[model samples]
Target: MAPWLIAAILTQGALALGLLWYLGTIRIPMVMRGEVRIDDIALERKGWPKREWQASNAFDNQFQLPVLFYVGAGLALYFGPTSLEVALAWLFVVTRYAHAFVHITDNHVIRRFAAYFAGLLLLCLFWLDLAVRLVLSL
Candidate 1:
């Protein structure tokens, strides 16, 4: 509802679009062509189709999940700032980056699962927050 909140949501949307672009231009292409190892520049230095590249795709996917969340949360905020929705929005951003980190460095099951859980939790929160807003408004 507030202009600042809308701006924040817009930024979040842009971030999501950036992730989508990364997926389309980079991930999908590399996956399709079987060109691994990040970029050909990396390949020039080393080789191709490395696990890191795959991990990067996964990382981006993880980050993308939050985009939907912020959009939802932002809409909810237009109604009012319930801690629930704001908290969920924050969680969405955190989990996304955490997922990216785990994919990049840790690459552990626990970390991955936490990231997944966080994302799913945020997704659930979006609807719950929205529902509350609707019910309360009515």
Candidate 2:
């Protein structure tokens, strides 16, 4: 596997750790304080403390956009990208970390969107790179 793919996996692991950290530190307190019941932990509900809620939402965001990232990394590893592609992959991971930070902190929409869009652009670059390689090879 490519080093970039390993970094991408680690990025996903970091996001999962964020979710776990929130569940243990934030959600557990809400449950203890009676702000949220154990039953209320159901995904169908949205009754968490503000920061905890944001953490949960940010965690959910991981599953959404990062799926594309995982796919891109897998394809990149398989296709063998240039060094620039590897750097872009790392940039995408860093942008996700930034997005999560903004989301779980001030909940700043514009900052989060900036990070999100930057990552989106990186993902598009990955796809474009793959397409160009495929075209040149054929």
- lDDT: which candidate is best? 2
TM-score of 2: 0.87
Where is the poorest 10-residue window by lDDT in model 1? Answer: 41-50
- Each model's TM-score? 0.59, 0.87
Q: List the residue pairs that clash in candidate 2.
A: none
Candidate 1 residue-wise lDDT at 36: 55
Candidate 1 overall lDDT versus native: 0.63
Where is model 2 poorest over a 10-residue stretch in terms of lDDT? 40-49
Instruction: Give model 1's TM-score versus the native structure.
Output: 0.59
In candidate 2, which residue ranges exceed 4 Å CA deviation?
39-43
Runs in model 1 deviating more than 4 A are: 1-48, 62-64
For model 1, give the RMSD to the true fold: 6.6
Residue-wise C-alpha lDDT for candidate 2, range 6-34, written one tens digit per residue: 77668776886867787579877777789
